[model samples]
Target: MKTMKMIAIPAAVLALAGCATTPGPDELRTNAIAMMKASFKERGQAKLDRIDQDDMQRLCSEYVGEKVMPKEIAQSLEKAQQALIKYPADGKLLGDWKLGERIAQSGVGKQYSDDPKKPAGGNCYACHQLTKEEVSYGTIGPSLYNFAKVRGYGEQIQRYAYGKVYNSQAFSACSSMPRFGHAGILTEEQLRHVVALLMSPDSPVNK
Candidate 1:
């Protein structure tokens, strides 16, 4: 009887193990989330909530280039981002190019070691070629040198430039560019300066 019981127990364990297959989509997602939570630690101004993916991010990750999101869905997302842009109450869209140059060069703030009280950089140069003199600029985005000269420093261009910087998603639904103003990474004043860096005739980017 003891020998028969042992054999039956082994058979039952093997059968249960054989029944297991790949994790379901929900289970995979849950496991991925758990792994992320376990990997990150809150420090300084950064918190665990920062690891949480928003609806947009989750959808972007899930679909990516595998499928095209509906036109209405894309338009709605862009519209939402456009509505969030906080234009200056004074209606002035430009700022000092010299001051803007410094802001563009300084890529500090937002890191655990960074001082939140200090202003952050747009890091545009890290992803774009904004000035002909700056040979070390990145190419993640198109070159902005002579931006005003080529695109024309017209009202429409100015507004588009400002809007693009304020919330990139307004132009491209899922642009790689950081939503500088919308993300609160750059303030309205700072945005105006960066726009000037790209649009001002006297700015190096225009030269």
Candidate 2:
């Protein structure tokens, strides 16, 4: 009985030691990505490549649901994203605010069911309170109500707004906001409209 007890004790200790061994970050990441790729199917505009992450995206994914990214890493990622932003050639930032409002309210685009020929929407309301009349707005992003009034309706501010809508990650790394222009989700004209919606003095957003 004593000999049997000694053997069982070592066996139990070995089992516990094995259980304590945690997978390394790279191993965990590889397993997770492989599982995701295996689970999802490509459909329409949504291809398998969409699951693949770029350098910044992979970095962000590694930190997500685990811990906040280090400040240096975040800043580095933001700098890389900012470098990719493309401004208009005509130097005009603002567009028709009325059309901008429509684009802001729309949530249609980039889905498998969506018609590729049709213009995609900014869907700003999905993450922001753009107008006072909008009773239903998401809290995921900050409110832009009276944006121009508070931020000042200037060329600089307009340019900033346009760039942010184009690539939110340029300003905030790993931001939940989509990179509309960077991802080709919105056209240059559509981006201008969205910018106008936020920066126009006469727009409902400013009121």
Question: Which candidate should be chosen as best, given TM-score against the real structure?
Answer: 2
Against the reference, the lDDT scores of all candidates come to 0.83, 0.89
Runs with alpha carbons beyond 4 Å of true place in candidate 2: 1-21
lDDT of 1: 0.83
- Clash counts per candidate, in order, are 0, 0
Residue-level lDDT tens digits of model 2 in 1-207: 999999999999999998997999898878988999999988887788888788888788878775989999999889999888899999988888999999999999778888888898888888899899999889999998999999899888988898898899989999999999999988898888889888887899988
- lDDT, candidate 1, at 179: 84
The TM-scores of all predictions, comma-separated, are: 0.86, 0.88
Q: Mark the regions of model 1 whose C-alpha exceeds 4 Å error after superposition.
A: 1-19
Put down candidate 1 lDDT per residue, 44-108, tens digits, no spaces.
97878877866666665565666877788778878877887777888888997877888777778
